[model samples]
Target: MSQRIFHHPVLGSMEERTALQFQFNGAVYTAYEGETIAGALLAAGVRTLRVHEETGAPRGIYCNIGHCYECRVHVDGIPTVRACMTLVTEGMCVTAGSVLPTPLKKGGHAK
Candidate 1:
């Protein structure tokens, strides 16, 4: 999806300027302070958030209430982090890219 997902500002007034900035898909975006990167995206109405590390399957923020594992993403340089549970930091660069290569599934091969 395009960066047009957010224009109206869901967290607060843009003029007030707690506007946190970051780059996603090469486009610069302004989110908010104290909100999780995932929360900021969701508030901006971002749909497709990331791809699976092992399968490259398209993934997004599921279980908005934060019980499901679908929202896992990489923050800074950390891996296997639950984006929904973390707080957004100013100047933080979060990339929903991939986790490390997982071990083989069953039968000595990937699932």
Candidate 2:
């Protein structure tokens, strides 16, 4: 899918801005500074962020707001972060929920 909204039928031309790079599932993608992580992923054509832990069903962003928890992802080793609420940062590392490793406790012990 196209990563840009050049001419919105309603909003017309979007303001131009510098782009940033972030890693999703170890692959780098370009993102705008103010866009949320879910928006960035959607712009890059990433439809699935994770699979169900038990059922293995695929999941993506839903409800765009923070309530649904359906867009949970790991950001820079921190798991369960809602992508729809988290803005993308340059060099940020994002992982799909299904492949996220078990989080560790302080002092290096696995939680």
Best by TM-score: 2
lDDT (Cα, 0-100) at 12 in candidate 1: 50
Off by over 4 Å in 1: 1-17, 99-111
- Top lDDT model: 2
lDDT of 1: 0.68
The residue-level lDDT of candidate 2 at 64 comes to 90
lDDT of 2 by residue, 11-57 (tens): 88868867999999999999988989999899889989888865568
Residue-wise lDDT of candidate 1 within 1-111, one digit each (tens)? 324233466765444437777755455566776667677777667766678777788898888667987877667778667778877776666677754477886458655
For model 1 the local lDDT of residue 96 reads 73
